[model samples]
Target: MWFFIQAALYDNNITFSTLGPPKFIDRQEVPNVPLNAPKPVIGLDASTKVATDAFDDLEPEMIYLPLSAYSHYRLRGRSQNYPLLYEYFDINPYSGKLETSRRVSDLSMLEIVTGSMRPLHTGDFVGLSLKLVYFFFGILLSMMIFSGMMIWTKRTYKSTQTLLSRSTKAPSKTTKPEPSV
Candidate 1:
């Protein structure tokens, strides 16, 4: 869950919510619509435009041609565009979208892992799996912290007991003979 949130924030170029509004890259621009226009209806194609108003609220990063299935590429910053950063798997055996990209062949394993210049999609099974993995690890980390505290407390109790015993014994041993006078 934390990974997903960080990815969301990083992709959107938003450091903090209070800093500013979120931004995204529109895959394509609506015809006759100005690029700088506010809240323009956006879509991949002309017919699909009428059906989906989902992208209407998002701030567009860039207007480009030949919009893909996953269009919204979140912005990294003012200087560079955020790379595509997701991988999808087909649940159905009969049909699946084949992974094909002009850029994918050029990407190294580290690049893919870091999402340096990769594109992310919403329906990515791998990305979703990672979220679940991180959640489990987070729980495990909390358990480890609790166990460590318990060990420290036990050690502290033992040390305190030893000190109390030594102090009491010293008081008894320091007593002087009353017949000295």
Candidate 2:
């Protein structure tokens, strides 16, 4: 799988297929890795016995512990196979893994797939999906029904108009006035 391949070959300097290979650079030496790393702001609140706690301030975000501080982190006896990001946070990365993957590390294996990654609420996705489905089929059905109605109504209107026009027109075949004498 791509995840395993990424994990395995990422640690070593190796070339994969034309699909492009993972570029392996020693992690310890890479200053840019930490510099370029995106840290999403996380916040929390602490309550005192006297007052209800409110979120005080945004704290420094950390996804992965720096190599120097890895000892201070409580990674404990977790295996190397466990993602480094999860290890540092003391959070269970595997919480959603099984539902998200058919087997281990199957990123592409999912029950529902959208074309691109976008942040969306669960209800938003469900509602949007339903709306899209309804829009597609509903418009098609409406168009067909409208077309049929137009055809039927147009023919009836045309026929009635033709008859009305003919009847209303002065008779072209008016009989010649009979001789008075």
Best by TM-score: 1
Pairs of residues clashing in candidate 2: none
Off by over 4 Å in 2: 1-127, 170-181
The sequence of per-residue lDDT tens digits that candidate 2 reaches over residues 1-181 is 5456556865896643222332232345223337566532212211110011111221213332323421111121111242211111121121211111011132232312221122121222334676577678778999999999999999999999999998989676778898998
Q: What lDDT does candidate 1 reach at residue 156?
A: 100
TM-score (C-alpha, index-matched) for candidate 1: 0.37
Pairs of residues at least 3 apart in sequence or in different chains that clash in candidate 1: 24-61, 25-61, 83-118, 84-118, 84-119, 84-120, 85-118, 85-119, 85-120, 86-120
Candidate 1 ranges with C-alpha deviation above 4 Å: 1-43, 46-102, 108-129, 172-181
Worst 10 residues of 2 by lDDT: 94-103
RMSD of each: 13.3, 19.0
